[model samples]
Target: MNLDLLLEQVRSTSLLEWIAVTFGVSEVLLAKRNKVWLYPTGIISICCGAIVLIQAKLYAETILNAYYLGMSIYGWIKWKSRNQFGTPKITSSDSMDKVKTWGIVLIGWVVLYLFLINFTDSDVPIIDSLVSSTAWAGMWLLANRKVENWIWLNISNAIAIPLLFYKGLFMFGLLTVFLFVIAVLGYFDWRKILKEENNELQSV
Candidate 1:
């Protein structure tokens, strides 16, 4: 698409879409810095996102956005829970976290794909389900403060970009692209933080 046409579509976006995109950007930026505030911002973003996806006939993403609302709440609570030193420290995934993450991805894909094929008039069931399934795994891991969450989120964002544009959600497609960049930065930043924390513990 031409720059002029893209700019026009952006200007023509609804107020709700603007809100969703704004908060969505904030959510990812805060998440990249490992802030607990990301969850609340994400809650606001996904609530609006759910409506936007519904209008675009992206049933899987709409459901995933709704699931994000609950996960945001759960993540907020979990992030606030304090350990002996402070709020729960960020860390890399362990064996069990990896297992559960994979389970969410596989099971989420199967169930969402079947639901879309049988119940919804969705034309992009495969890619749509892949987007949501990876996102589900990411959100679950994020609640546990796992560094690997960014990896899964970036995977979802990568798959979701073209699909969002194909559905004429140009604004959201752009947001996903921004999210992709942030998730990439978040992955490396979180890993660095984890290493620093581990070093501090060893020294203590």
Candidate 2:
């Protein structure tokens, strides 16, 4: 793709895709900063993504995005709920939560892969399932404001970048790279926030 052709495609991009990308970028940046606004922004991004993926016949991705929609709503509710003392703080996943996250990845991968192999005519079932499953687990952790969500999300982003480029989606590949960097930063930032929260608790 030459520079002129890429610019043409950018100009030709659907309004919905532009909206999706715009909200998606905002969502990730807010998430990196541990802002509650990410969920609402992400809900819009995920909805637009699902519509775009459905039009492209990417059924698995569409479903994954629908899952994100539900999780985003759930996350929004969870994030907004505060106790009387108003102390809903950032935290790391406990041992049980860690086990559940891994379980989601492994089982989700198998179920999605089998669904694709048995039902859909998808050409890239394995990698697609891996990416979606990891993201599914990551979204679950993110809904609960877990620090490890960034780790799981980045795993999906790393796999997805090459896959998107392989499918000739250079724009999406670049977007995933941006997301990968933000997730790395979000991980460390969350760790720092978690430490501060723990210290604050200790002082009381």
Candidate 3:
């Protein structure tokens, strides 16, 4: 297979699409490095994605993309203000906090599913809702510099791959497939970075 063909397809995109892809690719790299700037980059990417999807007539995904744009903006501001000097301070939490966060995420997913069912006419409303809610949680957690965001990201991309294909976005489906693999690798990479940071702190 010619990888150049794939690159050409993406390269032929409109200006907004180009910006969207650039920001998205940057977000992925920044996310792997646990950088705070990823949130703002995400906002630009999602805004572009929303335009592309809406034009393509994938209403459910279009709405989700719009939501992502708003989410990225909110997350960017939140993350920027959360820590001193705008740097994420990696820290461990107790079991109770972890349980509470997970519980909240589960409940939020269920509620979001119900909400989408009431508002959207999509046949795959449940799956759509699940993906949106989970991705929202992942974005929120990432904004807070939480380690578990990777898990939610992995789950979201897992669902999104087939969903995009079903919606006839062959290129987007391929993109999500790539994202899924990257998310898995990102999980381990961030974990290792975190451990290394901890060890260096101990040594000092």
Evaluated with TM-score, which candidate comes out highest? 1
TM-score of each: 0.97, 0.94, 0.77
Flag the better candidate by TM-score, 1 or 3: 1
Give candidates' CA RMSD values in order: 0.9, 1.5, 3.7
Off by over 4 Å in 2: none
Output the number of the lDDT-best candidate: 1
Tens digit of lDDT per residue, candidate 1, span 1-204? 899997899888888899999999999999998899999888888988888888888999999998899899999998888878889888888998899999999999999999999999999999999999999999999998999999999899999999988988889999999999999999999999999999999999
Instruction: Tell me the tens digit of each residue's lDDT in model 2 across 139-178.
Output: 9999998899999999999998888777655556677899
The collision pairs in model 2 are: none
- In model 1, which range of ten residues has the least summed lDDT? 47-56
Q: For model 3, how does the per-residue alpha-carbon lDDT over 4-96 read when each residue is reduced to its tens digit?
A: 966776576578766776788788888787776887777778888888776654555666677677767776676566455345565444586
Residue 176, model 2: lDDT of 86
Query: Best to worst by TM-score, what's the order?
Result: 1, 2, 3
Clashes of 1: 0
